[model samples]
Target chain A: MSGTESPAVAVRRGRPRDAARDRALLAATLAVLAESGYGGLTTAAVAARAGVSTATLYRRWSSKEALVLAASAAFAADLEQRPDTGTLEGDLRILLRDKAAGLTGESGRLMRALIGEAAHNVALAEALTAALIDPVRDRVAEAVRRAVARGEIAPLPDVDLVADLVIGPMVSRFLLTAHPSDTQDTQDARGTADRLLPFVLRAVGGQDASGDGGFA
Target chain B: MSGTESPAVAVRRGRPRDAARDRALLAATLAVLAESGYGGLTTAAVAARAGVSTATLYRRWSSKEALVLAASAAFAADLEQRPDTGTLEGDLRILLRDKAAGLTGESGRLMRALIGEAAHNVALAEALTAALIDPVRDRVAEAVRRAVARGEIAPLPDVDLVADLVIGPMVSRFLLTAHPSDTQDTQDARGTADRLLPFVLRAVGGQDASGDGGFA
Candidate 1:
């Protein structure tokens, strides 16, 4: 996913960093991003918001693109905290529900803008695909692997394809009608989980249809 | 989806419109849209592009939103012309393949931009959902109906939901990696159909696992 990976990254060693300052800057960056968009984001604005000097901001990240990517990386790391309900069905249900919650309100707007902007901006696009898409996809793969280990699903030729199958419907519908107030707004994450789980369950070859095997 | 619907529209009688002129205008609107984005589109530009007067443009569409909606309607109408390969599987393979073709190159850029812009612009979002989203969804529903009529599939509990299920994976994957030059660019529609068709067929309960029924 990181198509623009530099040789320096592989060989670079970490320097002692201020954890609290980094958190503050990232938080300020996310706030600005949520309010404006990627196009409107500036390192100066982020520094002002964080009460840090521009030089300090530049010390950690090179540019607005670099800062946004770091914030996205932090965001993605949070998304990797998956629910373990002892069954694939339950785990997926909770996972999808959590995803739904994230895709609403301000956070949803930020995500939509980031994904949309990725189409035009190559650097941001590659970074997002690397930090956001790949890790979360791997997390889903790990969940499926657990399901396979537990005999909840078959030993399929392609586990990643199955992950896409499970996530596609909810996300597709979500992206189409994610507005705050619309007549055909079907952004209800809980309800989406309810309607879509059966098909996913069946697709994975899960034996328990009764919602007992982690569905509830 | 048509949030702009009014009782007047239902009661009003149609004024005769020139079919060829309407086509030209819509074609021009799409051309300009593909070249530029929604933010860059203007009525004067569309009129000039179509070789029609600004008066003529306004005579048909009162505003830029109206013109874009009309063009979207034209796009949706073209999507409705799905190939009939004598079986649901064949029809869907062709259908998805055709969709994939549309999503590549210039047309793909237009589509991606439209979807992304819809998140910020409510009017465009509503018009697109009404003109583009609903009509194409109806087309999928029609395919399902035809399959049912041929006894190739069962009567679905909810045809629209099933349509979303069929389309979600392809569109989701398409939207994520839509750029022309990206390392993770998996925009091959034929390959997408090959991987995705089995799931769609299984979901709809098609008889022929072999591509002979309509897939080829």
Candidate 2:
């Protein structure tokens, strides 16, 4: 319910899949994704890049979509899906920082391709919706709900939109602008989350959800 | 220099170019953009749709890129590009509302294609940059700067990023999700703009830029 990664049961009684080769395959996905881009990703290229056979790759994933989906899911391992520091502000800052760290080379580029390609490919869109996007939405909503229950936010206006506003800039950066080494984007996301927290707290008005300014 | 649309120099002479036909050509461009999206858009299609010859269409627009750019320019006719409402809030609201109004049909599709294609299309991107994107960015930046001069915001941290955060959601929405209606999309954009303005103002630190519980 909390951490990311889809369920994939290992084959029931085969030669116990090679964990090392699996890592290479995932690494190969990122490699091919970075080297060529979405248009250039292919099973043969991925297998070759990973130094594994096509049959080995096929055993794990039936299609390129499935392979990319699994690899993208693996990328989430680097992300802390919902780290709760007991206070929203602290949790958010850490969350943002971790995401900033995750913005290294291939991961960001792969994310861009996934998002951009989703517009045209219905299957990828659906896969993305269930696997990545919705999970994020649900997680943000959960934090808001916790805030509401604890009487932090006023609980009046739509929580979903509030969550979008909180996280939307991050998505914007992920899609539109080139990644910045400057802390402006980081500070922006942090500040936006903190400022909006008060309004959301007021909206979901209560005694103040722990009254700990999430930013500070 | 101050507007999204730069006035082209008069070619001076030659039958004034059939007013009715010009109107029809632009209308046809919109229809084609709406129906075919970016990749499918063509001058040939526009010519056929408008009942104009290939020669006539080519005479006015040297290529497909030229036609799309011209049609994009045509879309800017109704916008007053950052009207001086004497207040930052008022100017922003108008700008946001005008952008919202653009979410429907061919204009929406064309704008999406323009940006998406900009990543790959060099000449089209340059033409669009001059004809469309830069002007809007300049006008919005100017409006924010006025807010700064008037002590409406603190002082912009990063002008371009501020521009991105301000307008980013609209672009994201246009490209990312399929909203049900233009009216709803516009309202969502206005709300996002209002919510984000305070943080932007505070970050910029202007006296008049108090957020004042705007997100509600």
Candidate 3:
């Protein structure tokens, strides 16, 4: 997801880092992010929660921002598990469901807190988007691309629009509306896709672009 | 704009409100919003900035929140001005350009602040979305709808997706990106649209959805 791979991140050879401790620190960081927000999260509290020395915490992450980024990276890795339902629509249905589930979890709260951070902290926001939003988006786009290749559906009118259509309203439903996380997710995703289908069909105008079956 | 009108708006009997004073007050309100954020804006400062009295401001808007809503209303009104460029792609180009321009202005900054407010303040966010985002979206949707009616585009796969595709990246660009204002708007909007065109065209699935037109 780092658009540019700047080679392997080489750390100076030293005593082996504690992988378990690192994981614990990330959990504490995420907990703090949800409870206190980025501004309020304290390194001492994170260290206390992770059961590591404050110096150790600082040694691992230079600042609270770095700590948050580390926490976010861990969340990003966990969030990577998308449901592969085979069909583009099927895979999306499952993937979006999983995403909505994640949104209301610790990750969702961290994401909300991180969004607030974006207003003032450039690097943090960029890290959050790159580490979080873009990777999943690419996967969705690839699934749609495959659908087109298989003639399962028409080519998209505008794939970017299609992706946005797929991604946008789910966000709007969550961020803008007061829809409960679990209760309204199904309707939100379906409704958004239903709305997007017509536009997608139009953007792919060609012999194969015409509707093949009754739209779901 | 009122998908469903509020019951709270009291009966009104007015000769004519001062157009000049109202305009001045709105302008002052926007200034206050930008300087101190939505939370920092106040009736007193808005009045003083407009060279009016707090009583005069209260006569028009009951509270700070109400005043902000009124300010947002003015921006929303401008958002409804439809651009009929005879084709869907062409109209989108204009709408997206204006959306970029709108974001470049005070309204955009104010919007970011208010959307942040929405995250914390439920009622205000609902009002902002209803008063602002939804209306503009409906108009744009209508424009896309008209394009479909004219055979200039194919059927909308999901109208909501069409809207999202049209607005999502723009929203992502504005809210997520760290850029100051819409400096890279033209390139961003055009580039995003260009990339998504293939998928979007396929989604539309039209004979002539292979677009060959301009928004103008």
DockQ of each: 0.26, 0.18, 0.28
The positional error of residue A161 in candidate 3, measured at the CA in angstroms, is: 6.4
Model 1, span A1-216: residue lDDT tens? 132444355235322335677888998988898777777889999999999889778877988888999998887776667667888878777666655655655666677768667766667777877765566567667777898889776665445555566556665666666353223223566676566666555555554456443222
Q: Which stretches of candidate 3 lie over 4 Å from their true place?
A: A1-17, A39-59, A81-106, A137-166, A178-216, B1-19, B39-48, B53-62, B83-94, B104-106, B144-160, B186-202, B206-216
Question: In candidate 1 chain B, what residue range of length 10 has the lowest lDDT sum?
Answer: B177-186
lDDT, each prediction: 0.68, 0.57, 0.63
Structural RMSD, model 2: 8.0
Among the numbered candidates, top lDDT falls to: 1
lDDT of 3 by residue, B1-216 (tens): 122433233223222345578888998988888777776777899999999888777766888988888887886786677878786656666666665555554556676677656555567866877776677678678877887789765554456555555555566656655554424455565566555544433444422244351110
Scored on chain A only, each candidate's TM-score is 0.80, 0.71, 0.75
lDDT of 3 at A51: 84
Q: Model 2, range B12-85, lDDT digits (tens) per residue?
A: 33235555677788888867876665667888899999998877777667888777777767766655465788
TM-scores of chain B, in order = 0.75, 0.75, 0.77
Worst 10 residues of 3 chain B by lDDT: B207-216
Top candidate when judged by DockQ against the true structure: 3
